[model samples]
Target: MEDRKLTVRAVERALDILLCFTRGSELGLTEIASQIGLHKSTVHRLLTTLEEKGFLIRNPSTEKYRLGIRIWELSTHLPVFDESATLLLPAMERLRDRLGETVSLYLRDGFERVRIQAVQSEQAIRRVAQIGARLPLSVGASSKVLAAYAPPEVLRELLESAGWPDYVERSAYRQQLEDIIRIGYATSFEEREPGAAAVAVPVTGRSGNVVAALSLSGPVSRLSRETLVEYAAVLRETAEEMGLMLP
Candidate 1:
């Protein structure tokens, strides 16, 4: 019982320290201690712990603490139907309605992409992807969009694991990723499944990382080059709106 109390106290103190910088971009040790009402030594120790765990980073030049990338990275893994998804559903539905195509929300899962939410098209001959379906991040428009924004380490790991097409050269694939980043979206025609085409845009997080991909898919005949470009513009617009809603 005593040990549990101590653990709770430590957690509370750590959370307090984290909360101190919420109102500001960064905070010094003394400022954090004063705000959290903790001793300077205790605050320093907590800061060191958080820094070691990648939850905080100390600026060498300013000697102040700021939230770290790990926080944003972790935020990307929140539950599929969490607040971010809830906020995105209506927009996805709207897109599906507008284009009469299936729309999906895909999140990166290592060398794979998982469809977390989907709005299927009403057309009798429309493309459809199941929610909670895990697909390889090597072939689809959604895959390319996620891979284009994935960290270099992730891309290297995927390549090292033979997660790319044997026909495509590494340099060419890298160039494709660069083009996706530059053009703000990706498109695939019968890349994953025959007769299917998709256009996907990156859904960025507060830190500007591509946390998810919003895609619209349909029959190849319906998603021609001109139609694909038109759909990509709409998807990019919706994705931008969705990114603004992420934490």
Candidate 2:
């Protein structure tokens, strides 16, 4: 538990096991051991400890492990979430009300995008972005904005890895990222979910580097191209104000 260089072996291995799920939502004992290069016995023991601490859960039927609610609880405590969520709630609510759609704030975490704050539409049927939800950084408008603005090496690594859809050409994908930056926003239509559409703008920190994405989401039936274009302008302006509040 020391802040110094000496990392406790058991703790390190436990953290590594938790990280294994970042690639996939669930993993069996053998799969985890193979990925982390550890023995089944060691993995099982660590998994047991993690489960007891409420950090992981095992499905009784499938026997696969997945991250537990404790992870979600911890995510709420992250400094970025703690600070930004409260600071931006008013803006998100206003944006949501004005746009008549769901507005969400997404933060990039590893190869995933986390929804730290959200204001849902008043309509009976609307897109709901769950707080603490972790989604692939390869899809959706917010995901594109977040990944596109990540550090160069990080973006390059992502571009060469599992982020892009198999059918999308790499060269064109790179240009799209450039366009998102040059145009100051991004858009996705049913990329992550069927019938869903979204527009995103970058939220920068004090460093003038993108720290998160502000996205408005709705059903395709409502968010037509013209509507999205108008939404982009509002979102871009709101994102700029939100960025000023970020450290």
Candidate 3:
């Protein structure tokens, strides 16, 4: 007989329910159950357990559920999710201090890149990335670097799923990936959102695989082609340093 699984899938489902609340919303039980495809009773059990742990709170009058304070305390040790940012913040700070530009850390999640950490420059003009913001895979410097350096299977799946929409369909997205590989970084402007220009470089683990992307972002006015080229080199060096420290 196969070895018994260590953890119950119900517990996993419950955790997923808690994480979904990270969007900062109040959701009713039906909505939560529907999202995760669990029976009402199952979701209720999960919610009750989570509530006991202070991970979820149910409104008495509204019957809505929202994340609880215990999650904040529990999440302090989420190294896998926060490691890219936590490990790189000091370097990002230094980059901002030296270059007077904003810096952010991104990691690939399925077909998207998520900005986990960002620090703004002290300059009168600055760029900011809202933490937990998600960006599509087909656009922007960070996404390109992620695509280029990601595992081959991940790259293939991401490109296949992205569907090459007209927004990025005009550009040779494949060729762009090739260039990102050859050049060791990527630069793009207004591809995902207008007026934003960015440069991104890969952060490699000890095994020499890219695990994350470190990027500099600002308005196109300040981050011209020449400026981006210069920033790319800085980003690559910094990211390489940060990657070595990863567990």
Candidate 4:
């Protein structure tokens, strides 16, 4: 069978409009239209359709559009971000207690890694990666772990979206990520944020696909490279055990 030559111009335009409203900037129809180079009427029609479907909503007072709760509901069904987090939380909790360091379950969300669940360590000096915190995928132990295990296509897509940032040299970052995959885990100190250090290992599903990452983090002094390397074995063991228990 041959593929059909289908046109998705309108659909692509609608998605582009939705992408414009990110991180608290609710956009008006004209703004969205201008950004996407679509006529106001076309954008309005697309927005109205999306609003009726509960993917977008209009503010009566400001007349601006923002993403609706339904999108959040749908996001919860993503197996990697939601189910993997739920499945790994118990193991993460136990690992946190055993290691006496912050433990987090993370999954790739677009160009960032999202901390779906984090157990803060009860130590005099500890690192804190808040739940829902988004970190760039090209930096840090958790992010590197996720990127190292991700499919080639997915990693390519994320890098393109992230653009070329100079925070870290691109070639060195790529080499680091390659080393992470070779070692089956990753460790970083003060890469994404100052005063933080962490190590992370990939968590695979029963089908042997990387679904999430498990990490232990703390202050650089406490979670030194040697300490992180020591805990890396524990993280890998715990993640493997959890993978076997998932449905």
Candidate 5:
């Protein structure tokens, strides 16, 4: 019982130290100790342990701690779908068949979006998206659809961190995000990659919160402006169907 209590307390302290860096990019030992109400020596020991374990890293120049790449590596292994993709795979396949384009399902992972599933187009001249690929939330139709419906706090964080295109004014981009939420879909024309176009719609969970994005993508030569709008309707319908079935 004593061992278990000690282990739990250590874990709690470690988590507290980690959480202290969330509001900012990096933090010093004294700042973490002050924020978590721990002694400076205790915080130093915990930070050293965490840094050795690859959960945190100390910048040589700043001499402050920040989250390490191990966090992202571990997060990529997390099960984003939880059997929800299995339920939606057939619908995605059907949508791909109907549109004759690549269909993909994307889920938000922290500030990024990951492609969890894909139904690739059979055509030789098609745009392909590999499964398990991570993309920035600021670009692409799938990412935009997920971002558009994200909670206010999450949306604000993404916008603040996102290096948006110079042509896209911050106020105008914010308005576009609002429009995407209002219209129930998003579109991208060679935005993330050249010669590619995509349209996407948000998949809601039982709580009515957006959980994923259903997207159709193809070569820009094939998926023109008119075609993207037409397929957007199909994507929205399929997303609604999946939303009803998600737990």
Candidate 6:
């Protein structure tokens, strides 16, 4: 209990020190100690730790410390969607209405793609994948588009872990992943389930990284391979516009 209290106090002191920097304000060790009303020895130790962790940067010539890029990296989460369903409803609905097919948003989850948001087509016969449905990263247009943009290590881990069948040659599958990235979109025909077809495109964040996949799906009877090109064009525009909504 005593150790926990000490840890809490240390965290509080670190936060207080961080809060001392006002916008565009840089300070030396003594100044920070004075502002936080702490002794120089204690403050200097904390400052050194912060600098080492990239939370603060020190100017070699000026010997002054300034808030560092690490703060901005953490700040990027501030505007992110807390409930993606509510945030993505409008975009999903627009696609459903325009394409007359199910519109779903799938985010990568380890070696899987989980549908986080969806708007089912109003048509009598339609594809209906419930929200939060988890599917393998190795199948479907949604998963393929996501896999194409995943970090090399992530994709490598997925391939190594999945234990694919002989029909799925690793080299050929890798080439297909390459094509998805090169073309900026992917299409599936009976990939995940028989009679199901979909076209998916990546939703890139401000950093140009794929954050999610926006896809339109329906029964092959209605959404044929021929229409994928046209639907993909629409999805590209919608996904690009929706990307702006992400943090």
In terms of TM-score, which candidate is strongest?
2
Task: Please identify model 2 stretches exceeding 4 Å from their true place.
Answer: 1-77, 162-164
What local lDDT does model 5 show for residue 187? Answer: 91
* Poorly placed runs, candidate 4 (over 4 Å): 1-84
Higher-lDDT candidate of 4 and 5: 5
TM-score of each: 0.66, 0.72, 0.70, 0.66, 0.67, 0.66
lDDT per residue for candidate 5 within 1-247, as digits (tens), equals 9999999999999998876765567898878889999999888999999999999999999889998988879967776588677778999999888889999999998778988889999999998777777787877888878778778898887767746556556676687788897888889999888999999988887897888999999899999989898888888889888888987
- Positional deviation of residue 161's Cα in model 6 after best superposition, in angstroms: 1.4
**Ranked by TM-score, top first:** 2, 3, 5, 4, 1, 6
lDDT of each: 0.87, 0.87, 0.81, 0.81, 0.85, 0.85
Q: Which regions in candidate 3 have their CA more than 4 angstroms from the true location?
A: 1-71, 81-84, 162-164
Q: What tens-digit string does per-residue lDDT give for candidate 2 at 1-247?
A: 4644344778889999998886678899999999999999999999999999999999989999999999989976678665768899998988988889999998998888988888989988899777767887777889889878898998888878855679667787788889998998999988878999999999987888888899999999999877887899999889888878888
lDDT of 1 by residue, 101-168 (tens): 99999999999898888999999999867776788887888998999988889998987785567865
Best by lDDT: 2
lDDT for predicted candidate 1 compared with the true structure: 0.87
Candidate 4's error at 139, in angstroms? 0.7
lDDT of 5 at 199: 93
The lDDT of model 3 is: 0.81
Lowest-scoring 10 consecutive residues by lDDT in candidate 3? Answer: 1-10
* lDDT rank order: 2, 1, 5, 6, 4, 3
Residue lDDT tens for model 6, 142-226: 9899889999999888788745555566787799899998888999999778999999999987777789999999999988888
Candidate 4 residues 16-91, lDDT tens each? 8776765345888878888888889988889998999899989999999988988889877676553656666777
| Clashing residue pairs, backbone N/CA/C < 3 A, model 4 | none
